[model samples]
Target: MKKLGRLEFFWAILIVITLFNTFLGEQFASTALVSVLVSITVMYKGLVVIDYFMELKHANKNLRWLMRLYFIIFPSMIIATVFF
Candidate 1:
């Protein structure tokens, strides 16, 4: 197990992303598409944070399943609701 938290790595990636976003903002209109991509990146970074920062890797299998379920089930439910 890693002794150190993953915050440093997360912070670095967040900084890089922020810098890229700043660059984009300067040259681009910061449209909805760019916002969506940024949100996706944030979500991905969040998963890493959950695994390492929260030490979810050492947690019980059931809890892990529930967490995973939230990611899939919640979003699917929202989409289904919209379609139905």
Candidate 2:
């Protein structure tokens, strides 16, 4: 895995995400989905950008973890919707 350059690594991940979404939308479109479909896609893209482009793993440690709270709210809302 380390042998793969960063761009190659991200490309591989992109392929996997594409395959997953294609499979998911076909299999479960009529079923109760767990997440907002847009968020699902944005999650994958954000992760790639953070890891490959931003190089967050290598940079300073002061990550604004608070920003992630917005992402968490989606699943929480989904659960809330199911419960009440």
Candidate 3:
């Protein structure tokens, strides 16, 4: 059995999360809790993509920070709007 590479591992994780979210969405109860869980998963997937898929892990510090900031700020805004 071949070991999965970093990119492959992240892809698998993202797929699993997406499937889980779909199932969770179908139930459609506890919107706040669901939203929070989805937001966290999205942030995790985004960071994984940014670092590995986007090849930003060893890129310029400024560029990496900018992308990280976008991921953090965008989800934070969505979560804030949902709760407040």
TM-score of each: 0.51, 0.51, 0.85
lDDT scores in order: 0.62, 0.59, 0.84
Per-residue lDDT tens digits for candidate 3, residues 1-84, read: 243476678889999999988887888885887888887888888888899888898999899999999999877776786767
Model 2 lDDT vs. the true structure?
0.59
Which 10-residue span in candidate 1 carries the lowest summed lDDT? 75-84
lDDT of 1 by residue, 9-48 (tens): 6668767877876776688775665655555555555566
Name the candidate, 2 or 3, with the larger TM-score value: 3
When superposed on Cα atoms, how far off is each prediction in RMSD? 5.2, 4.1, 2.3
How much lDDT does candidate 1 score? Answer: 0.62
Candidate with the greatest TM-score versus the true structure:
3
Lowest-lDDT window of 10 residues in candidate 3? 1-10
Runs of candidate 1 with Cα error greater than 4 angstroms are 1-7, 22-27, 65-84
Give the RMSD in angstroms, all C-alphas superposed, for model 1.
Answer: 5.2
Candidates, ranked, lDDT? 3, 1, 2
Where in model 3 is the C-alpha error above 4 Å?
Answer: 1-4
